[model samples]
Target: MADMQKALRARILGAGIVPRVIWGRKVPQGTALPYLQLFAVSDPRPGHLKGYNGGRTTRVQADCKAESYAEAKAMSDALVPLLAAPATVDGIKFGHTKAEGPQDLGEDTAAGFVHRMSLDLLVWHSSV
Candidate 1:
């Protein structure tokens, strides 16, 4: 099977809402504006009673961080429609992507402080 986490991260970048994306890590100081930080919202491999299907479902949170709230929300808004379209990235085929909760987080005052907007995602994928 294709690497699910990597594929998901790649997909977000490939979506082109923002080219700069970091997966499961802290962004360094002075990184570019309007980047995305991705984190798992649910276990990548949950217990499935029906043995292994060729595909897996994973949930992730994609955060849009920018110096301004408008920029952050705009980047996130761009992603909402893009996620709904199915596409293949890397070695993985995205069967579906659904987004939830733009959960307006106003501003964060730590680490790489910025106005942040986050979306919870349900991703369905398989190795192609």
Candidate 2:
């Protein structure tokens, strides 16, 4: 298990994604452990309308852990540039999750952590 974790971390770091490995916590029944989460913002190109990835991707999160901050930052940096150009992907908005509290906020709250990232990228990319 340790070796496998190391290998996965290496791959993620090599890929240049903002990798964050958080310990798993217990959840309700049927819940899985060690769920890894990933997020990425994307821009929608003109051609994407015909495909499944229609609009600009604001955020993409998956159920998995990343190795470190370098890896996760790398992924975010790689994606930041692409968003300014043009492309389509299947990603969620910053606050698309069902979680309450910090995850969910009212309009006046001014985008929280997740939304801030998404909105900032969107604004930057849109300006370009």
C-alpha RMSD of each candidate structure in angstroms: 2.6, 13.2
Q: Which residue pairs collide, candidate 1? A: none
Clashes of each: 0, 16
Cα lDDT, all candidates: 0.79, 0.31
In the range 6-83, model 2's lDDT, one tens digit per residue, is 333343444444334322243234332222333333334434455543322232333331233343343444444433
Which digits, one per residue and each the tens of the lDDT, describe model 1 over residues 10-101? Answer: 77676677868887767777787778998876755545698767777778888898888889989989887887888888788887688898
Looking at model 2, residue 123 earns an lDDT score of 20
Worst 10-residue lDDT window for candidate 1 reads 39-48
Residue 77 error for model 1, in Å? 0.9
Candidate 1 overall lDDT versus native: 0.79
